[model samples]
Target chain A: MIEIILGKYNYWIYIALMMIGFYAMIAKENLVKKILGMNIFQTGVILLYVSISKVSGGTVPIIWDKGGPYDNPLPHVLMLTAIVVSVSTTAVALALIVRIYKSYGTIEDDQIVVINSHDGDKEIPSEKASTII
Target chain B: MIELLDILLLLFLVICAVAAISMRDLLSSTIVLGSYSLFMAVVWTRLNAVDVAFTEASVGAGITTMLMLAALSRTKRFEFLYRKKGQQEDPNKETNPLLKNWKRKRFSVTKVSGLIVVLLTGAILIYGTMDMPDFGDPNSPSYTHVATMYIERGQPEVNVPNLVTAVLASYRGYDTLGETIVIFTAGIGVILMLRKRKKT
Candidate 1:
């Protein structure tokens, strides 16, 4: 049990981090909070990949005079691209959130749904419709 | 000693994650998320992933936070509990019992269901981790495959001191090109979504 805990605690902690993000993404009513959760979820996956690449007694994957042992470089390279993609995703999501706010006057997911449902029952006033257009 | 540092850093990460999600103010949550990224970068460095640490510090901690703050400037800062205009105007007005009950309680059915789903998925993922190799095991299968080839021949063939850069810029140049295109496409998408048309 001790050996398992020592060997796999990193993975367990990362899973906990991921679960927190997952809970926020699903349960949080605020749109921006959902986006924040998504960001945390992505970071957790990146952390898992980086953790997998570690080598005991290994230095960074930069070649020097003596270079027998080094951490895996592939995961690092992959995660570098993932980090950039994550930022790009965030930019797009924020843009959509801004547009959503412009139309609905609020960034809460439940409020947006309420507005949409209300739209079906009674036509939105002309001035509000103009802003949406 | 290093393992202890790793555990401490990860603990900090969990705290930051919880705080970021739980904060009522969106701006404060964004700032807390930035600190989370910063700690994540330090953890990456301790794990010998210097290149990834650099990217996480700049892109995750810096750019993402700035973008979130800019969005917050354009939107409301607080996650206000939204009530219908009718409810605000006349609290005594009769409404559907189900809707009224949901509005009164902080924890709705949606929240409880979401929590259940998240817990179920997390349990499955943790079960899957049982087969994974131990952390930092030098002879793990991940290090024995193409990773070994990349580390062995990367410096000699690519003539770059940093194996990560060598692989990213040369060995996996096509992949990097694809990623660059993804970023470019995302940029164009944001511009299209946000750009205002001239009055015609």
Candidate 2:
């Protein structure tokens, strides 16, 4: 009964995490909050994949004379690449944010749209507006 | 039977996701997202698909969150709500007080359509999952093919116990290179979008 409960618990946890992230992304008005939610959602995917890779009583991927079989190593390698890629992307995204902040004095989405659409004739460049600021 | 550790890890993922979304601050969300990705990377370790896990950890959790935060910093921190009370006067229409120099416009249909498209794509993904194989079964066709090949001859061919790495870096080296190119393209796109033009 304990084992069954534990198994059910794990399943529910994964589902809960997935839902939380999804809800946050959908409901949050704060741009940063949405991004955070996205992170949560992606993490959920990672958890699901990792959980699926386990083999009961399996040794680490390293082979030894006493071992029956080794745990799979493919997931680890994939994850390493993923980590590196995520960091690189983060760096670029942060750079873009800096640029955005420079251009728009305000980070409120509706305000920016209001400012941009006010020009009924000539198009105003975001850079130009920021320069004026 | 799986170990207790697996259950705990899954629980952790749930907690992080819930907290990340529930939190009011965007910065905290991004950070939680990063943690979420790192945890997912660990999950990849548990699953035998080390390569997929690596991609998820790096691209999904790491780069994606960073990109999102950067986008937020440039864009509006808060979404605007429309006001209805003050438009009664023909000559005294209330221009936006917040953006004194700018004009205000209502939300467009394009944005709504774009959102609908996103919802449809998500629905498709959920539907696709129904046809997938149930977890890890040695008798499954996927297990018998390339997955089994790696399990059987991975040590001999690449001398690496991690079959995913061997396959990604060696047998499917070209594919990995292509993936790298795609990432490069994304970087280029962000750069292009943000590039400042010099005034003549």
Candidate 3:
């Protein structure tokens, strides 16, 4: 039983990470914190796909002087794309946060609402928002 | 056995998930979530998917946490929980920001809608999985028809061991090009979101 469990430890870890990321994203109140949670969540999915591709006793993809078959390389390339996408999402999220801060003078969702409700400013379009930025 | 260990690890994952969701402090939850991602990286390694494992370690554990922290920095740390006794003292105090419409608050249509969405997604996923081959079965149709060629001829075509990459980037180069385009679009989105607009 122990041997069997050991064999699949990686999958367990993947599932655990996914749950934690999901929980954080759902539970967090802070916008920044939520973004952090989202990051974890996305990463969890990436890890899951990578783990699923691994094979035992596999060698690196590089063909060495020994001339032997090695592990697959497909996951690596796909992951590269995923990393880039995650970074882009992060950049956009941070920018949104900055804009929110500038307009409301606070980052809290509740506070922003209170401020906006009090202020006479209507829903500013993206065009107007960027102009102020 | 490996199976037992897998079960235990799965259990640990479940516990961490529960803690992450139930925890009161959102910041701590986010950090815990990061830990979860790191552990997942280890899982990927054990599965023998080295490439996937590496990406997970870097992107999942590294990039995601960074983004969450960035977003969190700009928002409130806590949800204001309402106290029953305090509300009686000041009727004007709107403790529940969501209490705008008594009817909506009494029966959260949004929550109901979210549940419906979750259920529909779950049903679709379950249905899709029914047609999928069992994990790691070499005899599956997926292996026999499409994957076999790549496994057999991949070395000569691309000089790469990882058939997955060969199929993704080289054979289906068009798809890869599309992915590049998608990334470019995402980058553009980030730029647009962050760009400073000129004053009138």
Candidate 4:
């Protein structure tokens, strides 16, 4: 039990973080809150991947003249790309949110849907109407 | 011990995430989320992931927060109340002013369905982690795979001391180019969406 507690506690903490983000992503009403939850979730996954590359006595992936063990480099390479991709996704999502606010006058998902149906029932712009459908 | 520090940092991360989600004020939530990213970077550093830590600190903590605050400034400032205020609907709208969207009542099955989806995801994640090798086992499959090859061979071939840089910029050069293109496309998409066109 002590070994389990001491050795694998990192995974447990990360999993907890992941679950928290999951709950927030599902339940949060605000679109901005959903984005925050997404950042948390991405960080958790990044942490997990980085943790998988850890070596007990190994140093960083930088090779020195002294021959020794090193932490895994493959996961680092992969996660570097993932971290950048996360930011790009966030940027596009936020841009979409801004556009939604401009057209519908609200960022809430439910309200946007309400307006879309209401707008459809009433007179819809010829081009914008097809785009909505 | 390192374990204790790790525990404290992870605890703080969890607190930040929960607080960010629960805050009704969008700006405050964005700030807390930034701090959460900062904590995540620290934890990555402790795990000896220098490159990952650096990226998370810069992109996650820095750029992500700026973009979120920008979006917050553009959108409705506060959360719209969703729960049915049947009996205790506040008469004075001046006290807690909300945008006009608060009038849209939605109690569809979406919330319950969302709960079910998240619970299933959590269960699958927990089960998946059970078979993963214990923390930092040198004999784990990950350390024995392409990582070893990169450390042993890629360094001398590319003349880069850092195996990560060598593999990322050389061995996986094509993949890096693809990622760059993806980021470029995203920037273009954002600019297209946010720019205001002048009516002549």
- Give the distance in Å from residue A42's predicted Cα in candidate 4 to where it truly belongs: 1.2
Docking class of 1: medium
- Cα-based lDDT at residue B190, candidate 2: 65
* Top TM-score prediction, candidate number: 1
Better of 1 and 4 by lDDT: 1
Misplaced by over 4 Å in model 3 are A1-80, A105-133, B79-107, B162-169, B172-184, B195-200
User: Worst 10-residue stretch by lDDT in candidate 4 chain A?
Assistant: A115-124
Question: What does candidate 2's lDDT look like per residue over B52-125, in tens digits?
Answer: 65576667766676676656665544333343557433222324464654433454454455456545645664
For candidate 2, the per-residue lDDT at A77 reads 45
Give the alpha carbon lDDT tens digit for every residue of B1-200 in model 4: 24778889988998998898888678888889988888888988888888988998899999999999888788766776545666544222312223444464565466677778877877887787778778888889999988888889987899999988998999998878888988998999999988889988
Considering DockQ, which of the candidate structures 3 and 4 is the better prediction for this target?
Answer: 4
Report the poorest 10 consecutive residues by lDDT, candidate 2 chain B: B87-96
- Chain A TM-score by candidate, in order: 0.87, 0.67, 0.78, 0.85
Q: Give the number of the best model, judged by lDDT.
A: 1
Off by over 4 Å in 1: A121-133, B81-104
The docking category that best describes candidate 4 is: medium
Best by DockQ: 4
lDDT value, residue A51 of candidate 2: 44
Candidate 1 per-residue lDDT over residues A13-127, each given as its tens digit: 8888889998888888889999999999889889889988998888999999886698899999899889988899999999999999887777777756766765677655699
